[model samples]
Target: MTYDFQDRVFLITGAASGIGRATALKLSSLGASLALCDINSTSLVTTTSLCTGSHFTHSFDIASSSECTHFIKDTISLYGKIDGIFNCAGINPTSIPLEDTTDEYWDMMVNTNLKGTYNITRAAIPFLKSGSSFVNVSSICGLHPFPTFAIYCATKYAITGFSKSMALELGPKGIRVNVLAPGFIDTPTNSGVIAGEEGVKSLEAKVSLGRLGSAEECADVVAFLFSDGARYMNGSVVEVNGGTAES
Candidate 1:
C-alpha cells in the first residue's frame, strides 16, 4: 500500500536527538504536523521548528508519570488528534554487574525505558484516532545478549511484549502497535565508537552487513511504520540493523 502521511499528526518522544530527530524531520518533510516532547527543551524546540505547520513542543521528563499526563494534554490542546506516536525517548546509563547496578540506576533505566513508553502510550490512548499507529523504539540488545546491559536489555524486551499486548487491546479501534528494533545506528550518542577508526572497525565486524547504520535509514522505516503502508502490520517487531540482527 502507498504510504501517504500528508497532513497527519505525528507525536514523537525523544524528538531532540538521533533516530527520533531524523524521523521527525522525515515525517515533517512528508507534510505531517508534529508534537515533539523531550526533556531537552533546547533541542526539542529545534525539532518542532523543523516540522511543517504549527507543530507543538513540550519539555517534559519521559520518566515522570505526571509530566506525561501534562504533555499529552498539551498535545491535544494544541492538536485535536494524534495520528501516530513514536516512543523514541530512552537511555543507557547503567553498565555494571547485576549486583553493582545501583537501585538508583536500575530505577532510572527502568523508568525511562519501560515506564516512559507506558506513560506516553497511556496518555495518548484517548486522543489516538482510529486507524492510527504507534511505533515503540526498541534496540537489538533486547533481542541479543550484551555484557553489562542486563536491565537495558530487559526493558527493551519488555517493550516488545507490551507492544504486542497493546496491539491486541487496541485492535478493535483499528489502532496498530509495533516495535522498531535498530542496531548500531550512528548517532551523536554513539559517535564516540562509530566515528572513531578503531571503534568503527569493531562495529563493522559485528554487523552481518559489515557496516554501521544511519539515523535516516532507521527513520525511513519509522516513517513507513507510521503511515498507511503499515495498516496491516500490527504487533510486529521490525529490525533495521542491516542484517546484524539476523547474524
Candidate 2:
C-alpha cells in the first residue's frame, strides 16, 4: 500500500545510516521533505545524495539536549513546521556481562539510546502540532531479555515506556506516538553477528523466519506509523522482528 506524504516535512535523527537512512529514503520516495541529522557528517551527506526529495542535513550528537534543541530549531526555520519525527539515533552496547559493565559503558548506552530519544522528542514537541506522529526505534531486546545485553535492554525498555506515556500525554492534542521493536536486522552494527557460517546460523536459529530483517522493512513500518493510514495507532509498540518474539 502506498502512503502519501507529499510535501510534508519530517525530522529524522540518525539519518546517516541503518534504519535511519532507509527511512529517510522511503519517505523521500513518498514525496516528503526531510530534515536529517547525525553525528557522522560524511555518512549524512552520503544519505542526502541518495535521496530524491528536498532535504536538509545537519551533524550533531543527539545525546546533547542543547544540540537536539538547536537541530529542531533549525529544522523549523528551514521547513516552517515538522509533521513527523523518527527518533532513530542510538548506540549498540558491547556483549559485556553486568558484572563487567563499567560505569562509562552504562552511561554511554543510557545517554545515546535512552536519553537521546528523550532529548529529540522533548525538543520537537512544540514544533509538532496536532496530527504529528512519532516513531521511536527500539529493539526486540526491549520486549525480551537477552544475555550480555542488559544495559541495551534497559535503555530500549525505557524507550517503550517513554513512548507510550508520550502517546497518552499527546493524544488530546491529536499527536500520535509509537515504538518499533526490531529484531536481528542486517545493519553495520550487527555485521559481526552474521559474518561467518557459525555466526549466521547462531543468530538465525533464534528467529522463526530463519533469516535477518532488512532496514527497509523497518522503514516501511515507520512510514505507516507516520502516515494517516495509521491514524488510530497511538501508544502502540509495533515489532518488525520477523517473528523473533511474540507478545
Candidate 3:
C-alpha cells in the first residue's frame, strides 16, 4: 500500500540499525520528516545519510528519562509537532540461565528495554495530537517464553502491557498505540544469537516459513501502523514472526 507522509513528522529510537534504520528509511521514502536517536552516534548518522527527506539525528541514552525528555523537546523544537513515534531502542542478550543472571543484568535489561519505551511515551504524550500513532517493538518472546531468556522476556512483556494500557488511556484522544512482536529477524541484533549456519537452520525450523524475517519486512508493518491503512488499529499486537510455533 502507498503511504504519503509528505508533511508528517515522526520520532524513532534505535535509529542506527536493524528494524529502526529500516523503518526510518521506509518513512523517509514516504516523505515523512524524522527525528532519529540512538546511543550509537556514528551508525545513526550513517542511517540518516541513507534516508531521504528532512531528518534530525541525536545520540543519547533512551533509558534516561531526562534524556528522553530532552529528545522530545528537541524534536518539537525542530518540527513543531509529532505525528508518530517508533520505540525501537532495546537490548537483546543471549540466552542465560536464571541463576546465571544477576541484579545488575536485570537492571540493565529493564532500564533499557522497558524504561526506555516508557520514557519516550511519557515525554511525547503532550505533543501528540489526534490521529497520532505509537508503535513499540516487542518480541515473540514477549508472548512465548524462551528458556534462559527470563530477563529479556520480562522486559518485553512489560512493554506489551504498558503499550496496551496506553492505548486504552489514549484512544479517547485519537492517539493509537500498538506493538510489533518480531521473531527471528536477520538483523545485527540477532547476528550473535543465531550462531552459525547450523544454528540458523535449527532456528528456522521453528518458523513455518523456514526462514528468518527481514528488517525491511518489519519496517513495512511499522509504516502501515502509522498510516491510514491501520487507522482503526489500536492496542493491537501484530506479530511478524514468520508463523513461529512452540516446540
Candidate 4:
C-alpha cells in the first residue's frame, strides 16, 4: 500500500542503520520531512545520503535526557512540528545467562534499551500535537521467553508495557502510541547470529517462516503505524517476526 506523508514531519532515533535507516528511506520516499538521530555521526551521514527529502540529522546518545530534550527542541525548531516519532534506538544483548550477566552489561542494556526509550518519548511528548503518533520498537523476546536473553527480554518487556500506557495517556489527546516486535531481522544488530552457516540454520529453524526477516520488512510495519492508515491502532503490539513466537 502507498502512503502519502507530503507535509508531515517525523522524528526517528537510530536512523543510522538497520530498521531505522530503512524506515527513513521509506518515509522520505513518501514525502515526509525527517529529523534523524543517532550516536554514530559517520554512519548517520550515510543514511542521510540515501534518503530523498528535507531532513535534519542529529548525533547524540539517547540515554541522556538532556540530549534527548535538546534533540527534540532542535527538531521542532527546524521543522516547526513533529507528526510522528519512531523510537528505534536500542542495543542487543549478548546471549549470556542471567547469572553470567555482569553489572556493566545489565546497566548498558537497561540504559540504552529501556531508559533511552523513556528519555526520548518523555522529551517529545510536549511537542507531539493531535493526530501525531509514536512507534516503539520492541523485540520478539519481549513477548516470549528466550533462554539466554533475560536482560534483553526485560528491557523489551518494559517497552511493551510503557508503549501501551503511553497510548492510553496520549490517546485522549489525539496522540497514538504502539509497539513493534520484530524477530531475527537481517541487520547489523544480528550480524553474529547469521555469521556462519550453522548460526544461520539454527536461527532460521526457530522462525516458522524458515528464514530471517529483513530491516525493510520491519520498516513497512513501522511506516504503516506512523501513517493515517493505522489511525485506529493504539496501544497495540504488532509483531514482524516471520511467525516466530506465535501464541
- Every candidate's lDDT: 0.85, 0.89, 0.92, 0.91
lDDT of 4 by residue, 1-247 (tens): 8899999999999999999999999999999999999999999999999999658999989989999999999999988999999999998767897798899998888988999999999999988889999999999888987788899999999999999999999999999999999988878778446467787787788888999899999988999998788999999999998877643
For this target, which candidate reaches the highest TM-score against the unseen true structure? 3
Error of 4 at 8 (Å): 0.5
Alpha carbon deviation, residue 166, candidate 3 (Å): 0.4
Task: Itemize residue pairs with steric clashes in candidate 2.
Answer: none
Shift in Å, residue 51, candidate 1:
3.9
* Top candidate, metric lDDT: 3
Question: Which scores better on TM-score, 3 or 4?
Answer: 3
Candidate 3: the clashing residue pairs are none
State the lDDT of candidate 3 residue by residue for 1-247, as single tens digits.
8799999999999999999999999999999999999999999999999999658888999989999999999999999999999999999877789999899999889998999999999999998899998999999988988888999999999999999999999999999999999999988778434587887788788889989999999999999999998999999999999999953
lDDT digits (tens) for residues 48-162 of candidate 2: 9999865899898889999999999998998899999999999876778899989999888999899989999899998788989999988888898889889999999999999
Q: Please tell me which model should have the higher TM-score, number 1 or number 3.
A: 3
**Candidate 2, TM-score vs. the true structure?**
0.96
Question: Which prediction has more favorable TM-score, 1 or 2?
Answer: 2
Tell me the deviation in Å of residue 26 in model 1: 0.3
Question: Could you tell me every candidate's TM-score relative to the true structure?
Answer: 0.93, 0.96, 0.97, 0.97
Clashes of each: 0, 0, 0, 0
By lDDT, the better pick of 3 and 4 is: 3
Task: Give the worst 10-residue stretch by lDDT in candidate 4.
Answer: 188-197
